[model samples]
Target chain A: MTFATRFRKSIEYQVVEELSRSVRWDANRIVVNTDAERLAGVCEALAKAGGIFDSAVLSSPASTRVPQVCYAFRMPDLGLGVSVFARGKNITCLSTRLDAAAWDERKIKDLAGVQLDGLEDARPLLAHPESGWGDFAEAVSKNRQTVLKPSEAYASREYAMEGTGADGEFEIPVGPVHAGIIEPGHFRFFVGGEDIHRMETRMFYLHRGLERQAVGRHVQRILPLIEQVSGDESVANAVAFAQAVEDLEGIRVPERAESLRLVLLELERIYSHLADLGGMATDVGFYASSSQFLLLREEMMRQNAALSGDRFLRGVVSIGGVDRNATQENLDATADALASFSKAFDELESMTLSSSTFLDRVFTTGKVSAFVADELALVGPVARASGKSCDLRRHFPYGAYKKRAVCESMAASGDVLARFNVKANEVKESARLIRSEINQMPSGPTHTGEKRTGHGFGWGWCEAPRGSCSIFVRTDKGRISRLSIRTASFRNWRGLERAVNGNIIPDFPLINKSFNLSYAGTDL
Target chain B: MHELSALLRAPRTDEISEEATDPAIRKVAALLRRRSGGVFSRSIHVRMVDAGSSNDVEVEEGLMNAPQVDCERFGIHFVASPRHADVLLVSGPVTLNMRRALEKTYAAMAEPRAVVAAGDGACTGGLFKHSYAVYKSGRVDEVVPVSVHVPGNPPSPYDLVAGILQAGLALDKKEAAKSGKS
Candidate 1:
């Protein structure tokens, strides 16, 4: 059977004939707005047809009293997401049917005050109840929805969980204060001796409210903030944001710009993955391999800094094209650096593999079953490590990915070691892609000043170092009215929760570091 | 003792090998011995405040398991309270929510304290320069007297360590000037 036919049959979506009364608008993607009642039926049909819910965002309309909850769905092989907007009098939650919509519903309930009547676990997702949900209420009202009262913010959700368990089942609350030099994230594990019973993760410590702040401001001005969403994945976020804006304006980026974007994106991915490799080594106490990778990462960062003014590759990508262009000298220097760095990276990988201490800790530890990975809808190297072949670059190509085929990396075991292997493999692939992209730079105007109107809906997806970052831009006239960005972190945080189950508390750092999902990305 | 000194001087990548006799490692060994002479005794108590920047949350929690910039290894202790602190670690572009938090933390600190602003967001609001939520258009120095600027998107732990050491050196200079006056 054909992949498409098999996929369609796997998820049973009723192929409905287009009704004459249905209002359809085609711009960036196909859009058909149906009443809230029809939305559930469509979702069921789409689910039956193997269309997965990519992301769902709920925001109360500024002028209307009724809430507007949007569900974004993607059919894997098709590379398309159809957003269904559901509105009603205190609408019923889709989380009941689709397990993925659970968190989305909680976020809606927290910010827009949308009461999802049948939500299974309607815990306050973004706000602290002790501080009062005032900023959340004010956010919905003022259209300034990002910044909430300090007491009721995303960071306040973490604290020591209180409870007693069976004999020898003592609770170990590890962080939101860690021992290493990494981002802040708290984990509470209910442990019996060495084995874990239940583990809960608390991320979002570095929420900058970039989403709330971006509203009302010119979309062009907000690209830099998007780049800073997480310091490491700046290029990916910038490209994703630019692609979204470009799609909305119905403009095609120049060929040279696209090639340069791909090159920079690959370079960015190289440095990011290098750090992850080094971090994984560090976690296993392999200082020799760790330091080697660290020094390599530092060298790459310096090269990147020379190519782009910012060390983190921030503020270089604009809405239409990149802010700066790489000269031939710059491309040549990067090519030369990658050639030598690849040798060093290979040696580091071998040294790490040979190290008994490193392998012992990561091999069978933090095993996330393929079944659980699919259930949680994991992405990036984490899911790839487990034999689930999901790469946004392969599935839905945007930017240079459409032209140049991506070398998708995967490992069968969803353990720390598998994640390490996937990341190591990706480093080589990213370098190969970067060298090719740099070699084939086309000459043309770097940017197109296409007018942005708040008239339609646009969506963009890019494979960030962590995973796939999807952006949905909803425009009012030519300016953005609403934007919902689901970073790689948002989709993959649940996998960490599952990966930690049955593992000892100390092994958490190694497992978490392997994933390296951005706290800022998820929080925002 | 001199033999131990000679051993320290060997150039090494993996570890300080007994038989290795490289010139570069020899030079490093000499440097280490000279520096290690005094037991590296010093501690600087620091009280960190987010200083109203978006960075307030991170500073309040002490930068996720990042080793407390232990100058005491070179000799320094990061104090929890301002009354005992000799240095103030401030992170922010200086936001409206954190303006009062900054002043209160600074006011509570004991005298002869040095302030080190530790991020691009804190050093200069970076991209968040024109927001209404921000109080100052520039660095933390504009609002609070800053002695050191450790700049990065978020500076590495080593950069942070280097900044704190710079602050300690500045403290020594201030102490010398005070003693000279006395």
Candidate 2:
């Protein structure tokens, strides 16, 4: 074994020896049960061992047992996941030491009714004050329907954002409904004239209680709901959830299905990134380039509809493997389409890059320093643009990625231009990956028709178009007892806040587009 | 210059033939064009409110602006504010948190405005209907008067355009009813 693998094994041994009540080792994960008091220490030790904080999930309360909280960390070097679970109503907060755990802890507090002893930001995360429903945690625990009072006068809740108190500072509150065709999110900008002094975003206006809705549902039935987590990220999220269920059942996906999935994923990434690239151009008032990008994106969406019967590419990924295999003719057609697409995309890229006006607007605008990116644990293109190599495809290879290495695309500037370059390059890279995956075209049965009945839990993760999307699922007799999803948007929203600080208000939308974090995914 | 030559070589429009266009979109466009001659002067301003959707509806709405569908060609424009809008295109089974916001947006619109509930979630609360977080059925009609329902997992851009045009007809009827009452 390599040194990093040996070091991680040693840390795992130490954690099991010192903190765990019982240890269960699966293929790519280690689940350790520990006390609530020791939760913070376990997380701290894992962090010291160079583990990246992935997500924190809260399981539903059983009749005789309290809800359990599982904190998952990614040991990228070893390609192993460490999940430390503690069953309790009160758990020690790791947010005091780990800034990345702040949002996860707050979400647990809101949904699970759990109290983290030292969580500083006590404001509600998912449950809004103006929602008019009683305490969400109470409603969830009691399994009671939310009582509606439409007669109650409409009221907007106040979000506290202390201004810089400089001579000309004032706050500009923008959306729960924006001026554009986008999801609803409220942005608070404290500005001194045109330049932004501080920026705070209050999201979760789109929370549909997806996790609570998953309870008592069969594992197979939940894929549709998981796909709803984010529209553009349907395949990635579905694949992640399916992988988790597959892990729980210990079913190996057929090699052909794995290759096909890689194709589908790369296609999704291509179209999704096209939208972002187009949006960035639109924000900068460069319609010439934006139109070309959108045109290509439209063609890509049509191609997706042809491959899978859905425009958004939903219902393709199932528990054991993919739902249907693509015929070689279809694969060849897609490869041909990709050839022309690459040509058009290259011209568009050069056209946008060569434009001095476009460059002037995007270059050095909305910069996220490497330190801020690391502190916030940003993922996907956002982290890669900031010089932090956090691509899950490289670090924790899964599915077809284990066989084929990804050519990493990154930039150190972390500006809007750097993000544009990274995302644009990623689209090209995705097209390349798709073409090669099709060329290799593994021929076999696409699924291992295994029974999914089981009583177990497992972690599933995928590098979504935005970033790494990780899901945690626990099943009882093939029914989902508990489900929690931590999308890349949840990890990277804070990075947007940091990127907007000191930048002008007009550039806010540009920066926001550059990150392109999913409000629905984050809210869910 | 290479840039100048590339710009010249680029096609100005996609120029998709009517036969290649989705029949649903063509039918809606024809209906909208005919209706414009009577009441609307061929223009309808719409403001979209995402009360609570998975955002598939939002993506379709954006696509409606793309060159292929080009809802603007049928005199439909997405305005910045509800005050300027002639219709409120709302997607939901409206979440409780967004209920007030949705209502506020509807109230902000001018008179004779129609609402189009786009997507399965908006019309019938689709998958999230049983969830506690949303209003009854997560249906837009539960919160607002939906003049038309365009239901798909998310209604495609063509269906969305059709629904909006149908909403325009509903708005014209509302206008006629109001003038008669006055």
Candidate 3:
């Protein structure tokens, strides 16, 4: 049976029938006006009936008559999406039932001052100790520039970690300022001798208030800002933001533009995967193969710089379509570069997998069994490596992805080796996809030749190198009213904590590099 | 490994131009590279701090350690601690969350320490300056004094090398000031 039919068969529309709510606007959005108490039951029923939590966004009173919160969910098998709007000064927390809602609810509670009644942890999500969460709530609600005194407000928070209670357990505090060029995040590990008993992550050191800064800006003006959300996934986030805006205005992107965008996304996926693989190799102390991977990455980046002015492929994706069209010469150059990259990449892959030391380190180290991954709703390679078929491209295929089906890579072991295998296989898949898209390249304008000055609420998602970078944009007139971006990294971080529970403290960096979650993406 | 050796010996079509390198900078860099175990300590240990970047700069920084750029050949090596660093390479605008961390890190650096502020964001705060959650200015100079400015959205790998070279000049100036000779 089809998923929608299955969903309908599973549960009657009893929740809505019981509430007697009027369905007001969109085909997917079920508009239910009910008390906070009734709304919780309605959500519980829908979630029980198979609503995968997408993201939760709480808007200021300006967006609604009262302070409002929307819990977004999508059922991939059915290709259906719905938003549950619960309007109140204090909204009910879906996290009571949904494990995935904890992070989103915590963020809402901290940023909007909406008390989540059953929240287990009351610790601030973004604010430092002395900054006072109240000032932040006021500033974000006011949506204006506010001063946070650097001396007092920006103090490093002292995170309290309960003792593991095992007689020999002790903590190893790793960084807000780390070695190398990676972003700042503090990780606390409690270990008894060599084995880690527990771990906690303290981030927001790289939090630059991306959502708060995006308010009241023209859609076109914020493309560059959105591109910086995560540099490697720049094209992916921009495409998601653009698709969300385009869907809002009911605009259609031309065929050629769509094809070009697909190529960009795939190209980005290739480079992003390479960095992770290279990182894994480095962590394993296999510098020779790591250096080779880096060389390959540099070549692809040079090609990106040639096709577009920016190497990360930023500044090219626009709201309507794209900023630049690919010339035949550029396409041919890219194809040739990627062709070489594939050949060399295969050799490097074999070299990496054949190395016994590398295998010994990554084989069963930091394995996240299928059950743990499923419980956390981890996306991207972390989930894929667990042998879970959670590919968004296969399930809710959008844009040019609807035309060409992508075969996602998955491994059953759910270890660092499995992640490596998945990433390497994905690199090959992306390279093949790029070649096919270029050959089937549609001929038309790169952009729709339309400038937008109107707005609506729309959702867009593109499979980033990491995984699904799902975005929701709400606009009024031309300015952005609310933007809720849930990057794969944001959802996947919890999986890291679970994955590292039984691993050694020394292997933490290796396990971390395996997942390679973006600190900035998660913080944003 | 044989294939890797062959690939290394093979000619590269996309050869990065030497013109991007300045003779004076190379002269100093060569001096540093040759002065190993000397009082000059030609090998400069760098510690990098990312304030509020998109991680694009980090990618480029990683590439610098790759076979192509291989920054260690020029006596510039990235160290793990600020205490051991002779130079500090920083990327991104100064975010409020990172302000104290950056300041404390800078303070922890030993004397003769030179800071190279990499990327347009680090140089001038770029697109992130006005955000409420960020330090209003966002520039590296707003928190810690910068010796050289590397400008680009996220400056190219070559631009970063040049900026690091300029930081060599800054180290000398810092030394001169310390000796009451400037």
Candidate 4:
């Protein structure tokens, strides 16, 4: 038996005895149904039994079904996922015990209007006060016909930010509109002179009600919407959503399509990391190396445009498989481009490493200790740089990643330089993976042509360029009833708050660039 | 001696030939120059405001600053504050949460300022038109008077440059109108 199967078989009796008698399997996931009151107890038991918190999703009430909350966990040793289901409007909060579930719980409370007893932070997460449409769940239930309050009423609504209140500490409020070419997010820093005492981040200015928009749409129609979650993470998010629909319907994607998907995903990783590296260089005033890195990044974007039609690689992934096939000529061209890119990239890396100015700025700056990384449940390069082995591709392999071995690049210091090194090494690894996948390109139809009719829920995940992106989908007769997305940016934003605690004021931009979390993805 | 030798060995700069310019950008650049009596052809400060985009538009704006495009050569510079700008480059389908910020940014700009909506979402709210969170189809024009609309899913760097240049022409018209009024 496979490892997941063995683990499921081993856990079946225990789940029945402790949690619920309705224990069953949904692919590699172990689903256990329990009462709302026992939700906290069951989650605590799972944690004690070596289950790491992954995500929590809330599905609002409908005519046919009551409100439900599903908490997912990952068993790293066995590569299995466990989802506990609880049905009720009022549920016990998991954040009181688990720090990682704090934002997830807050988001659930905000979007669904679900009441969580003993929730630590009761403030709104996505529903900003200035957003004329207040109480999203109420608006959804009313079919969006609720009268919007006057702008002036919300004009006075403000978010609360508490400072340390030290002898000379003062608060500095930065943007929802930043100085650079970046997305909007507000940061409040409590500083004593130049040193930061604490920092609070306020985001969701880009919230466009994506999850509510996906309701009642066909599963195939939502891929384009998912692509807009983040511009740079288009392919990874699309793949995660497609895989969720595929899992729900039990459709087997073609081997050729899987291989192509792998190629597209790794290409995305390379371009995304190049931007981070270039951004770090730019923030440190190393313009020579920064410009070179940006030049390489632009070349990669052109390569993406040549391979797929769009420069951002949108409209390429579909429900059952990829929308278009890569011709042999295109594959050959990509391999050739990657070879030259490798040489240029190596030279730039050495140049950056040898620069004492760049080294002085990056080393020991914005350090996120391994303890903080684990406590916050950070993912992607941010976590890996802090010596946490939480790569989703290696832990929960899917598609072509199942057959291939992905070498996880790691650093223990968790500083800006560590993040830079981690991202650089990941770019090299991604290039290697793409070249190999192109060489052994499979030959077959790129789609399965399976009927899209299903009445169940399933989970899909992919290790995006930034970190793990997970999607939860529920379908009813080929139409999506509900969907939830937990992006790496959403999980790592809190980690950025912790990372910027002790750093100085001017180094804020560099530290922010090192994390480079996506505001659009998190807001969505 | 080593530094002098390295400086001497640096590559020579080449003149930008007519063939090197994108035709779309050249057309807008010529229009802007002719309309402004060659004044704006030397300098046009731009301030960008992201109302609520998926960040594709911002990425394109960054690429416009890259070496391949190098918008500064065309006298299109992105400034830090709106008070220093000659035009506002805004992208969105304006979310209600960002509507006030967008309005504030537009209000912050000086007179003779022009606005360019830089993406399909900013022009017509693209895919998120009907959502309740966004204000009135997410169009930049809903919140501000737009001089130009560069409509793509997210416009390419060359298209963005053309749109900014078009906005520069609008700025010249605004200045003329103001002068006439005075």
lDDT of each: 0.68, 0.86, 0.79, 0.85
DockQ of 4: 0.53
Model 2 agreement with the true structure over A179-277: per-residue lDDT tens digits: 999999999889988999888899999988888888888898889999999999999999999889988888899999999899999999999999899
Interface DockQ of candidate 2: 0.66
Candidate 3 lDDT, tens digit per residue, A376-410?
A: 67788888999888777787777888898899899
What RMSD value applies to candidate 3?
Answer: 3.0
Off by over 4 Å in 2: A4-16, A22-26, A60-65, A149-157, B1-21
lDDT of 1 by residue, A44-142 (tens): 566666676677775323345676767777777566676777676576666677776677667767666766777887666654343233555455446
Once fitted onto the true fold, the runs of candidate 1 whose alpha carbons sit more than 4 angstroms away are: A1-11, A15-32, A37-41, A59-65, A130-135, A143-165, A452-454, B1-90, B93-115, B123-162, B170-182
Model 3 spans > 4 angstroms off? A16-35, A59-65, A130-134, A144-146, A150-157, B1-8, B11-41, B180-182
The Cα error of candidate 3 at residue A342, in Å, is 0.6
Best by lDDT: 2
Q: Each candidate's fnat, in order?
A: 0.01, 0.62, 0.68, 0.54
Which of candidates 1 and 4 is the stronger one according to TM-score? Answer: 4
TM-score of the B chain in model 2?
0.87
RMSD of 1: 7.1
Q: Once model 1 is optimally superposed onto the true structure by TM-score, how far is the C-alpha of residue A215 displaced, in angstroms? A: 1.0
lDDT score of residue B60 within candidate 2? 85
Task: Give fnat for candidate 3.
Answer: 0.68
The worst-scoring run of ten residues by lDDT in candidate 4 chain A lies at A140-149
Model 4 misplacement above 4 A: A1-17, A60-65, A130-133, A143-147, B1-36
